[model samples]
Target: MQNSFEYGSTRVKPQRFGDWVIEEITVSEDEAKFFNMRQAFQGKHSEMITAGKFLRLMQVSTGYTVMSNTPMELKSNEIAFKNARGSVLIAGLGMGMILEAMLTKSEVTHIRIIEADMAIIQYVGNFFKDDPRVEIIHGDIHEYEPASDEQYDYIWIDIWDDIDVRNIEQMAELNERFSNHCINMNLWSMDLLGCEPEDYYKIAM
Candidate 1:
């Protein structure tokens, strides 16, 4: 059964944090499990919209439906995104759930996405192509050269399944570049962020 909201002044403040709000939130843990199951097996738009097992970060309201792809990068303790202005560069587009959130923040003006996997980039661009705020770059973030005079407010690195740690030297180089540019760098570690049986959940909770 669908849930309905009893109208109230403050309650109708348009539940929004960033670019999203509590569209609907399923209360029952069992319902959440069932919803997750449906997403895992089901295809169509649900698969694209769903954020896998990372939906826990959303502060689901008493009666609102929330769809997310994994816990949001900003909400995760291991992964962090800071508020800033001007252009931002993001590595590893993933399903673009984070990118969508980024667009909602008025502080962010332009977005340059770096993705190594063509297929994933293609998928996200195809789905979100209509958004004029995003600029897609299909190449290795390590190889791409930020404009000589370009200074970004933020640089987010989440290459590979999570943060690509195999290339420590490359990571160091990127960090150095970010430091030089006075840009805040964020590295999203899949080892820590990926859906695995780990005790970090306790800390996160």
Candidate 2:
């Protein structure tokens, strides 16, 4: 790990993984690099996991929802809390920071996390095994099926692996699933104040 900088409401810092940083929470860098660093960490799976264990240990569950970091306060402070008691769906379940925050709120009833990696899920869930509100789903988001009677208030999508965006129909279906959803669909790369690519960091709320 290295010294950190401020990015929106969170602080960003370089970790062990290639050109990766953490904002608001510390991300895990303990495992072997499983995929391309350029696409996964900064691009899609930004919310799946974080570096710090304390943050994960403190979270109510191992589920999370994250979007753009530039407008951090906008998304964080303006979450839809009305008529939300049944369940909330999250695309990525990183270090469990966002879900941890959701649990702090009085309205959120449960969380269903959809993650492609089971190993990552196990790492986080091993700590919060006692929490009943968190449910981990080990599968791809494209294969997910929503119940006919189910409608979620919030759906956050942040993918770490490369996706086939040529399928517009699939994207549309994802859009229709959540009443409220946020996606960080762009890569935020920067090298500021003598910082390397690893030192660059931004949150894409």
Candidate 3:
């Protein structure tokens, strides 16, 4: 690790691999970041707030914010980590942190992670090169499909950047595609946040 590895809610320094960069490190709480955290981590996570510093992984090409290891994000992925077992199909390859967490579960026999970005698999894939259980494939989640007999025990989708009602539609679309392959399919925060399309609309109004 270049500086410090942050996963499941912790932060330190920024690291980079190819076009992918992880940053937003600070020794003290930045006021703007603090406010953003307060807005996002309100209600239950309000008290757990410590500092505003967090790791941000993003792609410089399209200015697409990849993912973070914030507490909210870590909390969101807990459901998938708990229920993951057997053959698993995961969408997205952010910072390779989730894969690090998934590798801890002995019940998880194999994981086939499908990422749309090729730059990620080229660089981030090096992190998991030693792990035979993980197979990172290059494909778009929307267009990718399994073989005729291909099936999985669990399917986890965290393809979106943040928690939004728009993600629900994406999840539904993915569900329609991969539902038959697994006993359970979990979308990153679709269940963890416990919000729906209606909730987001109400918030907007």
Q: Which candidate number has the best lDDT?
A: 3
TM-score-sorted candidate list, best first: 3, 1, 2
lDDT of 1 by residue, 22-128 (tens): 23333366655666677667532232222232332122344323323333333441243344347877876654656665665677788888877675555445666
How much lDDT does each candidate structure score? Answer: 0.51, 0.43, 0.71
As a whole number from 0 to 100, the lDDT of residue 103 in candidate 2 is 58
- TM-score comparison, 2 vs 3, better candidate: 3
- TM-score, candidate number 3: 0.77
Task: For candidate 3, give the lDDT.
Answer: 0.71
Candidate 1 Cα outliers beyond 4 Å, as residue runs: 1-68, 72-81, 162-167, 190-205
Per-residue alpha-carbon lDDT of model 2 for 74-140, expressed as tens digits?
2332332221244677666555545555555556667787877675466644545566877888988
lDDT at residue 6 of model 1 (Cα atoms): 14
TM-score of structure candidate 1: 0.54
- Count of clashes in candidate 1: 9
The alpha-carbon deviation from the true structure for residue 28 of candidate 1, after best TM-score superposition, in angstroms, is: 12
RMSD per candidate (Å) reads: 12.9, 13.2, 6.8
Question: Which runs in model 2 stand beyond 4 Å of their true positions?
Answer: 1-86, 160-171, 177-205
Task: Judging by lDDT, tell me the better candidate of 1 and 2.
Answer: 1
